[model samples]
Target chain A: MKTSDFRFDPSQVRTGYSHSTIFKEDGFGMNYCSSCGVRVLTQVPEGDHLPRQVCPSCHTIHYSNPKILVGAIPVWERKILLCRRAIAPREGYWTMPSGFMENGETLQMGAARETFEESLARVTIEDLMSVINIAAHNQVHILFRAQMDSPEHGVTLESSEVRFFEEAEIPWADLAFRTVTQALTHFVEDRQRGQRTLHLVDLETTRP
Target chain B: MKTSDFRFDPSQVRTGYSHSTIFKEDGFGMNYCSSCGVRVLTQVPEGDHLPRQVCPSCHTIHYSNPKILVGAIPVWERKILLCRRAIAPREGYWTMPSGFMENGETLQMGAARETFEESLARVTIEDLMSVINIAAHNQVHILFRAQMDSPEHGVTLESSEVRFFEEAEIPWADLAFRTVTQALTHFVEDRQRGQRTLHLVDLETTRP
Candidate 1:
């Protein structure tokens, strides 16, 4: 496949969002200190380079790091299981089972959990397929190759529809996010080459 | 090397800290909502599995996800560069140049930036050396193999001392964290075997 096949149109993505805007959407805007309920000041702390939301009363420097998006491409009998997202941020667009990695879980565990949560499919996570850095979105997308325990899966709260698709049946234009498209492409290419190489990509999102 | 060789003693590590304590230390404690400056409630929101610090006034559910600690094992002339941390959490103990990943940077970028910040060395990130999941600590440590730009490096504010060490000269017993020890071991083992492989590990920290 050509590299241009994955070049996302800027108009197709969510507009009017920058890195800081995405950070705020992830519940990271610190107008007030969570520790002392005091108003926070945006300033670089001593020995720190970046400006952080620091509290004057309790002296707490609040930090907001990039979030990890763990996911899995669940395979059963050479077919890939996908879900039509029922949530916003591309509601109706098709995507692999994925979500934010929660605390108290490994990457593999998070991938499996998200798969189950979204598609109602239990998967045995096999290998790391792709690690796509969406720096503009303040997120890293980690996708794993997984084997479905059973071919049984149904619709859930997170997914409007769930079904298995052959390689040719994937909807490239209807994929939820750029990271999803990139991961699925990597998975197909690696499988065709009979390789299990980890795909690392720093995705450059087009800004408006 | 045997698997038992990497088993860490709980007594040798930090004491009296659980996953919740570690979460609070990571600046995730939400006694009050940062958005509305009102007291927050710990409850599972609608259709959510885990209990989050939710704002009743703003209806915002505050999530605390696992954090990523990015680092690099800087390689120069077959020697590995390491730093002696001057800050708390294993002060003065030897560690790879690592810190919490910040916003607007890729994993490789964060690794290179942390290497420069702690050891005053510039590195071209090579490959994915190790990804260790410390679930109890709510952290995923991602270490990369990096090639030093030059042979010049000195002590920085984060590192009290910085130097390159041959394989035999590594201070394994004095390593700061279990994740560091595991990553370094993987690095050495892979180098000796003439292999470039991604090391994925779920470190089971011994609880007191």
Candidate 2:
């Protein structure tokens, strides 16, 4: 496939490496600075092959191999909380309270913060649930099981509406994304089975 | 917090309206382009507010939303099929065989394709196991459970290395990412619990 066949251009990101090679064979070690949007290249040994790129402006090393964090699933009586984007793609469609990991936070902390930010609900994270590797996009998605601290949390304007729906009442047609539908299906089925396995991991030094 | 506090700017990828301010209650209908990543300043009618972005280059209407597909916890008696990257980022790290959905391809097809590509395994995706909403960064991560088609689908250098490890033999120190440990934990617990619930959902989409 031609370089253009790929959706994104690494060169557009300008990480010092070939901003032109389409299918990159090395691990992505550099990245565009979030602050300045400048590409950062990583320091590698003369012969050592690393994928991360370092930013010359801010001096931050970008891992071409970025990782995704697993968050939690908070369920209310037969229903779960979801959000609708105040923005696009599926603006006004339904979604769960989710966001990316913030600096200096654990995966669970990121999940809890997002859940509260979007849903206005404070939840106590229960257990480590699942971790998903979406290699197509080069991300790692993580999941956790959490308990609702309050059932009275109101909805944010970020969501069109926030109400618990029975498994059968899920507005499948109106769901925000495909992942939301799939996740709800799994949650409902697991609840019916009444089997929840609580698992935790030592998060001393999660990926930096 | 100042808008600058946010690291990754959606402005680079989104168009039309200011993502930083669109979330304000008073800032309804402000739009962004799904393609050109331009922030358009427009007022959208309330309630009927439809905020969507269209990509300029690839006529692909950008949906900053999550999608789902299946993944496998493919295992032999004591070993599992893990993938090491031959590409960038965490190039030398290990991962599971997981991928996104394709047109007309069932979830199983996506899972199998990922497995074969990453680990070079020929296995039948057994049943719907778990759904993880790895939407933190953008895409969702889904996981499933499967039985290996053959035990001899030996290691291929397509990845750094493909190997099996007993529960006791898991190389905790050298794993690729956080999700690996999370997935492995869930797999082990499920095996011990007789695989009570075969499915899971990563509700809080954005974590890492």
Best by DockQ: 1
User: How many backbone clashes are present in model 1?
Assistant: 0
Model 2, C-alpha of B87: deviation from truth (Å): 1.4
In model 1 chain A, the worst 10-residue window by lDDT is A1-10
Mark the regions of model 2 whose C-alpha exceeds 4 Å error after superposition.
Answer: A1-208, B1-18, B21-62, B154-158, B198-208
Winner by lDDT: 1
lDDT of 2 by residue, B1-208 (tens): 0011111221222242344433332212224332233443333334322243332333333222234444676788758777766766677777777655432233444576567656766666554444443434333455656677677554554576777777787776766655566667777777787853433334343332
lDDT of 2 at A20: 34
Task: Give the alpha carbon lDDT tens digit for every residue of A13-119 in model 2.
Answer: 22423433313422332133433446445465233233345457665443333344444566777567666677677887877777655322344556776676667
* Colliding residue pairs in candidate 1: none
Cα lDDT of model 1 by residue, A91-177, tens digit: 999999999987777788788788888888888788777988887778999988988888989999999999999999999999998
- Interface RMSD for model 1 amounts to 8.2
The global Cα lDDT (0 to 1) of model 2 is: 0.51
